[model samples]
Target chain A: MKHMTLLAGALALSTALTGGALAQTELSLWYHGAGNAVEREILVGIIDDFNSSQSDWKVVLEEFPQAAYNDSVVAAAVAGNLPDIIDVDGPVMPNWAWAGYMQPLQLSEGALDGFLPGAIGKYNDEVYSVGLWDAAIAMYARKSVLEKHDIRIPTLDQPWTKEEFDEILVKLKDSGEFDYALDLGMADQSEWYPYAFGPFLWSFGGDMVDRSSYTTAEGALNGDAALEFGDWWQSLFTRDLVPGTSQDMADRETGFIDGKYALQWNGNWFGIKTLEAVGDDLLFLPAPDFGNGPKIGAASWQFGVSATSDHPDGASAFIGFAIQDKYLAAFSDGIGLIPATAEAAAMTKSYAPGGPLEVFFGLSEAQAMLRPVTPGYVVEALEFRKALSDIANGADVADALDAATDAINADIARNNNYAPAN
Target chain B: MAAVAPTNQRLKTSLRYLLLVLVGAVFIFPIIFMVVSSLKPDGQLLRDTASIRAFLPVGDISLDNYFAAFKRAPVGLFVFNSLLVTGITVIGSLFLCSMAAFAFAFLEFKGKEIVLSLIIATLIIPFETIAVPMLMVVNSLPSIGPDGLTWGWLNSYQVQIVPFLADALTIFLFVQYFRDLPKELIEAARLDGARWFQVYSLVIVPISGPVFATAAILKFLAMYNQYLWPLMVTQSEQFRPVMVGLQYFFQLNTAWGEVMAYLSLITLPVLAFYLFLQRAFIASIASTGIKG
Candidate 1:
C-alpha cells in the first residue's frame, strides 16, 4: 500500500510539470539575419536559454534576409499580423515608431546606462529599441604605403586636416603607383552613400537636416559648408583622385587589397579580412577632421516590441535578456561589429583591448554620430544620397544641394513636419 | 555560269549558318555562365568575371557551392513550393481561361464585346498599381482549411495560386486562338447535336495544341518568375517561391557562387518545361505571329 501511494505521488508531479509547460505563452520574434549561419546559431541559443529560463514566455523566432526584412515587416504591419518582437535598423526605428509599427521598449531602470548612445534608439523622448552592437568607419591603409609616401599616420586626437588629407591624395595619385588614391566605395549605391559620406558633410559643419527642429533642411544641406563638402566630393571624381559613380563593384571589393587603391574608407566589418591579408602593415586611421571634429555615421540593427503585440512585457523581457554582455560579445565576434557596451567589448575577441581591431571601439566612442534622429530621416537619407551621387557625377554643388533641400522641405511639409512643435 | 551560281549559293548558306550560330551563342552565354559559376568557388568566380574564363568550366571547379546553397536555405522546399503553385495555377488557368475565351468567341452573350474589351484593357494596367488592393482583398478573404475556417489567406498556397489563375494575358491568348479556328468545325459539331461544352472539348481543344503549348509556356514562365505578389502575400517561409527565396543569398556580403547555384537549380524547371513544348510553341508562333 505504501509503494502504491508513492507511485500515485510520482504521477501527480509529472502531471503538474506538463500542465506548467503547456501554460507557457508563445512570443514570436522576427529577425533580419536569415541566411547568416552564425547569427542563426547564436540567436537559437538565446531563444533556447530564454525559453527554459522562464515558464511565463516561450519566444519563437522567424528570420528574413536583411535585404527583404523591411518590406516583409511593412507588409506584415499592413496585414495587421506583425510578430510580437521585431528587429529594426536603428535609423529606421523612428519611422517605424511613428508609423505605429513599434512601441517603446520596457526594461529595467538603468539597464542601458553603459550602452553606446548610437546603439540606443530613442525618438520623441522614448526608447523604442536597443542594439547589441554598433558599426564604425575608418580610413583603411597599409602602414607600408603610408610610410613610403611620407604621410604621417593620424590618431583620434590628431586626425588629418582637410588640406593635409587632400594633399596626401594628390601625392598618392602623382606617384602613379596605384590606379586610384582613394576608394570611397562609390560602387555601393544604396544606404552606403549616406552612411559613409554623410559624416563628411557633418564634419564640414553641414547636416542632412536641422536636428533641433527635425522640420527643415534649409541652411543645413544647402549651406556654405555643404557646398564646400560637395565641391570637394566632385573633385574626388573630376580630378581622378577617386573612382566615379560608375565604378565597378568587383574593383571596389578587390582593388584595395590588390594594391590598386592606396586607401579605402570602409567599416570595421572588413577590417579582420584586410588584416588577415595585409598582416602587420594594415592600419585603421581616424577620418579626416575637415574643419569640424572627425565624424563617422553610426547605428546598427536593434530589437524592439511590436505595437500590435498582445504581450509587450514578454517581448520586452526577451529583448532585455538578449542584451546581456555575453550575447553582445558573441554577436560582435560573429559579425565583427563594435559591441554596444565597454563590458561587452572587453569580452569580445575582436573589440577587446589589445585586440587587432580594438581601435574601432575608440572610434565608435569618440567619433560616431547618429544620423538625423527623426522620422523624416528616411526621406532625408534618400535625398542626401541622390545629391551626393549627382555631385560625384559633376552636377553643380549648389544646385544639387538646393534640389535636395527643396525636396526634403517639401516632404516635411507634406507630412505636416513629421512632428509639429506644440 | 551554273558552276558560279552553285558556288554563290554555298557561300550564302555558310554565311547564314555563321549568323545563326552567333545569335545562338549570344543567347546561350548567360546560361552557360550561371551553370559554370555554380560549380566554382566565390573567389574564382569573381576573378574570372573580367576575362573570357567566366564562360568556361575551368579552374577550381566543384559542387561545394550547390551543397552550401542547399544548407543556407531550403532550396528544395522553395523549388517544390514554386512547382506546386505553378502547376496547379497553370492547369486551372488553361481550363478556366479557355472556357471564357470559348464563350466570347462562339457563344452569343449580352454585352460581350464591352466585357471582352474591359478584360483586355486590364492587360495595359500594370500589376504593381493593383498589388496593394489585391493584397487587401486577399488579407480579408476566408478559406476552409484543416482548421474549420480561417479568416485570412495571408500565408497559404491557395492565395498565391487563386489570384493568378485567370490573368488577362492568358484569357486574351486563348480568345485570339479560338477566334482563328475554323467556324465550320464548331458549326458542324453543333449540327451533329453536340452541346456547347462538347463542341469546345471535342472540336476546338483537340486542334488547339499549339495555342495550348504557347499559352502554357508563357503562363509557366510568368508564374515561375513571380516575386512581388508572392512576397506580399506569403509570409511563411514554407509557402515562399524561388524568386523570393533568391533574396536569402543577398546578405551583407553576397555569396555569388551560392547565388549562381540557386539560380541554376531554379532554372531547371523552366528550361525543362520549355524544351518539352518548344516544338508546338514554335509552330504556334509561326502560324500566329505571336512571340514569347
Candidate 2:
C-alpha cells in the first residue's frame, strides 16, 4: 500500500510538470537582421527575456537578411505561413497593412507616449507598428573646411537659406580644393534615391504627394515650387557642384572623409565612423532651409503583428516588452541609430546629450518627415525616384516631373486610390 | 620557298597561341579578382578596383574577411545544406530521368511519343511562371515524417528535393543520349533471356557514363544555385542554401571583402565538382553537342 501511494505521487508530479510545459503557447517571429551580429544578439536577448517573463507564451525567432526580407515576407504571406510577429520598415508598414499582411499593433495606453513621432507607424488612423529607434539625415561637413571657406555653419535653429547654401556650394566648388562640393550618394540607386532626396522637395515647399488628400501628386510634384526645386537639383549636376548619377560607389563611401568632397548628405548610421576618421572636425549639421523648412526622411524598422498570427495579444505583449528604454538604448548603441525615446537616448552612448551624435536625435525629432502614409506611396516613391534620376542625368525637369505625376496618378487609379473601404 | 613556308606556319601557330592565351585571361580575370580581393581589407579592396592590382595580392593582406564572414553567418552549414540538397537531387534525378528515358528510347508502348513530347513541352514553361502555382501545390501536399502524416511540405528538405527530382531538361538529355545508342545491345541482351530491368542495369546504364555525368553536373549546378524557390519555401535558416546565405553578407554597408570571401567559399564545391567530372563532361559535350 505504501509503494502504491508513492508511485501515484510520482506519476502525478510528472504529469503536472508536463502539463505546465505544454501550456505555454509558441509564437514565431520574423526579423530582418539575419547577418547583423549586434542586432541579432540584442533581439535574441529580448526574445529570451520575453519568453521567460511569461508562462503563457514562448517566442521563437527566424531572421532574414535585410536585402531579401521584404520579398521573403510577401512570399510567406502568399503561402499563408507568416509568423506571429514581423518587423517591418516603418514607411512600408502601410503597404503591408493594406495588403493584409500586418495588423495593427496592440500596446498599453502609455506604452509609446514618449516615442519619437517617426518611430510610430500608422495607417488609416490605426497604429500598425512601433520602432525601437529612428534614423536621421544631415549634411556631413568638416568644421575646418567650412571655417577655411568662411562658410557659416548651419544649426537646428539657424540653417542656411537656399541662396546661402547654393553660394556655399559654388564657393566650395570654385576653391578647387576638393573634387566635388557635395556627395549626395547618387550611386546608391535603391531606396536612398527617394528617402534622401524627397526631403529636399519638402523643404522647397513641395511634396511627393499632396498630404491633404494623399491621393494625387499633381500640384504637389510638378507645381512651381517643385519645378524650382527640380531646376536647382539639376543645376547641382550640370554645374558639376556635385557628382552625377555615374558616381562610383567607392567614391561615395570615401569621398567626404578622404577630402574629395567638401560636404556629404548622409545618415546618422555613418556618423560614428566619420567621427572616428575625421576626429573633432566632423560636424553633423542640420539640413539647410531651402525655403519652407529643413526636412529629412524619417522612420526605421518597427515591430508589428502579422494578420495571420493566431496569437496577436501575445505578439503585442512581446513588442511592448521590447520597447523598454533599456532595449531601445541597447539597439541605438549597437546600430548607431537615434533611440526612439528621449529617455532611451539619454541612456545611449552616442545619442545622449553631448555625445558624438546627440544632434541627430534632435534632427529626427524636429526635421524628420514620414514618407507618404499610404499604400500607394510605394509606387509613388518609385516614380519620384525615376523622375529625380532622369532630371539629375540632364533630362528636362518639367517633363520628368510631369511624367512622374502622371505615373503616380496612374498607379493610384489602378489601385482604386487604395481607399480604406476596399 | 620551303623555309618561308615553315616560318609562316610557325608564325600562324604562334599567333593562334597568343589569341588563345588572351581569351583565357579574359575568362579567368574575374575569378582571380574575387580570390585576390577576398584576401584584402574592404578599404584597399575598393581602392584597388581601378587598377590591375585588384587581381594581384599586393596590399595589407589578411584572412580577416574570411574570419568575419564566418562570424557573420553559418558559412559551413550553408555549404553543407546546399551540397546535401544538390547531391540527393542529382542522384535521384539521374535514376528517375534515366529510367524514364530508357522507356522512351527502347520500349514500345501506347502513346510513348506523345508522352515524351508532353514532357519535353514543359521545358518552354519557365519556373517563374509556375512558381506560385507550384508553391500552392506543395503547401497542400501531404507528407509522412517522424511526426506522423502532415499536410504542407513547407520548411522541409523534401520540399526542396522532391519538386525538382524529375526536371524536363534532365529527362530530355537522358532520352537524347539513350536514343543514339545502337539497338543491337538491347536485342542481344533479350536474346540471352535477360529481362528489361537486367538489360537496363547491365547494358544501358553501365555504358551511359557521359550522359549521367552531363545530367548530374547540370542538375547539380541548378540545385546548388537555387535562390528564389528556396527563399520562398524555406523560412528557417536551418534549411537555407548557399545562394540565400549570400544575402546575409549584403547588409546596409556591404562588407565587400567578406562578400568575396563568402563567394570564394561557396564556389569551391562547384569548382571541385566540375574538375572531378571535366573529362566525362567534355566527352559528353564533344559527342552529343550539348552545352551545359
Candidate 3:
C-alpha cells in the first residue's frame, strides 16, 4: 500500500511538469539567415535558451534567405500570415512599420542605451527594431602602396579633401601600376550603389531625400551639391581613375588584393579575408571628405514584432532576451560585423580593442549615419542607384539627378507621402 | 563531271557539319563553364573566368562545393519538393486543359466561342499582376488534411499545385493542337454513338501524344522554375523548392562555387525531363508551327 502511494505521487508530479510546459505560448519568429550555418546555430541556441529559461513563452524559428526575406514578409502580411516576430533590415524597418506590417517595439526603458545609433531602427519617434550588429564601409588600401606613392595616410578627423582625393586617384592611374586607381565595385549594381555611393553624395551635402520633410526629394537630390557629387562620380569613370559600370565583377573582388587596383571601397565583412591576404600592410582608411565630411552607409538587420501578432509582449520578450551582450558577441564573432554595444564589442575577438577589425568599430562609432528614415526611402534608394549608374555610364549629371528627384516626388505623391495607416 | 559534282556535295556537307558543331558549342559553353567552375574553389574560379581555363577543370578540382552547398540548404528536400509540385501540376494541367480544349474544339454550346476567346485572352495578363490577389484568395481557402479541415493553405504542397493546375498557356497549347486534329476523326467517333467524354478519352487523347509531350515539357519547365509564388506562399523551409533554395548561396559574399554547384545540380532534372520527351516535343512543334 505504501509503494502504490509513492507511484501515484510520482505520476502527479510528472503530469504537473508536462502541464507547465503546455501552458507556455508558442511564438513564431521569422529570421533572414537561412543559409548561414553559423547564424542558424547561434540563433537556434538562443531560441533554445530562451525557451528553457522562461515558462510563459516558447519561441519557434523559421528562417528565410536574406534575398527573399522582405518579399516573404510582405506576402505574409498580405495573406495575414505574418509570424509573431521578424528580423528586418534596419533601413527597411520604417517602410514596414509605415505599411502596418510591423509595430513599434516595446522593450524595457534604457534597454537600448549604449547601442550604436545606426543599429536602432527608429521611425516617427518610435523604436521599430533593434540590431545586434552594424556594418561600416572603409576605403581599403595597402599601406605599402600608399607609402610607396608618397601619399599621406588620412585619419578619421582629417580625411582627404575632395581635391586631394581626386588628385591622388589621377596620380595613381597615371603611374600605370594599376588597371584603375580604384575599384568602386561598380559590378555590384544592387544596394551597393546606394549603400556605398550614397555616402559620397551625403559627404557633398546632398541626400537621397530631404530628411526634414520626409515627403519630397526635391532640393536634396537635385540640388547643386548633388550635381557636383554626380559630376565628380562621373569624372572618375571618364578620367579612367575608376572602372566603369561595365567593370568585371571578378576584378572588383580581386583587383586590390591582386595588385591591379590601388584602392577598394568595401565593408568590414571582407576585412578578415583581406587582412589574412595582406597581413599588417592592409589599411581600412576613412572615406575621403567631399567637403561635407567623411561618411559611409550604416545599419544592418534587426528584430521587430509583427503588427498582426497576437502576443507582442512575448515577441518583445524574445527580442529583448536576444540582445544580451553574449548573443551579440556570438553573432559578431560568427560574422565579422560591428557589435552594437561597446560591451559586446569587448567580448568579440574581431571587434574587441586592439583586434584586427577594431578600426571598423571606431569607424562605426565616429561616422556611421542612418540612411533616410522615411518610408519613401524605399523608392529614393532605387532612384539614387539608377542616377548613379547612369552618371557612371556618362549620362548628363543634372539630368539624372533631376529625373531621380521627379520620380521620388511622384511616388511620394502617389502614396500620400506614405502616411501612417493608423 | 559527275564525280566533280559528288565531290562538291561532300564539301558542302562537311561545311554544314562544321557550322552545326560550332553553333552547338556556342550553346553548350556556359553549361560547361558552370560545371567546371563548380569543381574549383572561389578564388580559382574568379581568376579563371578571365581565361579559357574557366571551361577546363585544370586546377584543384573537387566536389567540395557540392558538399558545402548541401550543408547550406536542404538540397535534397528542395529538389524533391520541386519535383513533386511540378509533377502534380503538369499532369493535372495536361488533363484539365486538354478536356477544356476538347469541348471548345468539338462540343457546340451557347457562348462557346466567347468563352474560348476569353480563356485565350488571359494569356496577356502577367502572373505578377494577379499574384497578390490570388495569394489572398488562396490564403482564405479551406483545406482538408489529416488534421481535418484547416482554413489556410499557405504552407502546403496543394497551395503550390492547385492554383497552377490550369494556366492559360497550357490551355492554349491544347486548344490549338485539338483544333487541327483532322475533324473527321472526332466526327467518326461521334457517329459511332460515342459520348463527348468517350471521344476525348479514346479518339483525341490517344492521337495527341506529341501535343501532350509538348504541353507536358513546357508546363514542366514553367512549374519547375517557380520562385515567386512558392516564396510568398510557403514560409516553411520544408516546402521550399529548388529555385527559392538557390538563394541560399547568395550571401553578402556569395559563394560563387557553391552557386554554380547548385545550378548544375538543379539543371540535371530539367535536362533529363527534356531529353526524355525530346522526340515527341520536336514532332509536335514541327506539325503545329508553334514554338513553345
Highest-scoring model, TM-score: 3
Write model 1 residue lDDT over A1-422, tens digit each, in one string.
99999999999999999999988999999999987888999999999999999999999888887878888888888889999999999999999998899999999999998999989999998999999999999999999999999999999999999999999999999999999999999999988998999999999999999987988999999999998998999999989999888888778777898899999999998898788878889999999999989999899999999999999999999999999999999999998899999999999898898999899999999999999998899999999999999998888999999999999999999999886333
For each of the candidates, what fraction of the native contacts does it recover? 0.42, 0.56, 0.75
List runs of model 1 lying over 4 Å from the truth.
A1-11, A420-422
Q: What's the distance in Å from true for residue B92, model 1?
A: 1.0
Interface RMSD, per-candidate values to 1 decimal = 1.2, 0.9, 0.6
Better model by TM-score: candidate 1 vs candidate 3: 3
The positional error of residue A236 in candidate 1, measured at the CA in angstroms, is: 0.8
Per-prediction TM-score to the true structure, in the order listed: 0.97, 0.94, 0.98
lDDT of 2 by residue, A14-64 (tens): 999888878999999999999999999999999999988878999999999
Say which prediction, candidate 1 or candidate 2, comes out ahead on TM-score.
1
What TM value does model 3 have?
A: 0.98
Ranking by DockQ: 3, 2, 1
Clashing pairs in 2: none
Off by over 4 Å in 3: A1-3
Residues B229-273, candidate 3: write the lDDT tens digits.
Answer: 999998999999999999988998889999999999999999999
Q: What lDDT tens digits, residue by residue, belong to model 1 across residues B119-150?
A: 99999999989988888889999889888888
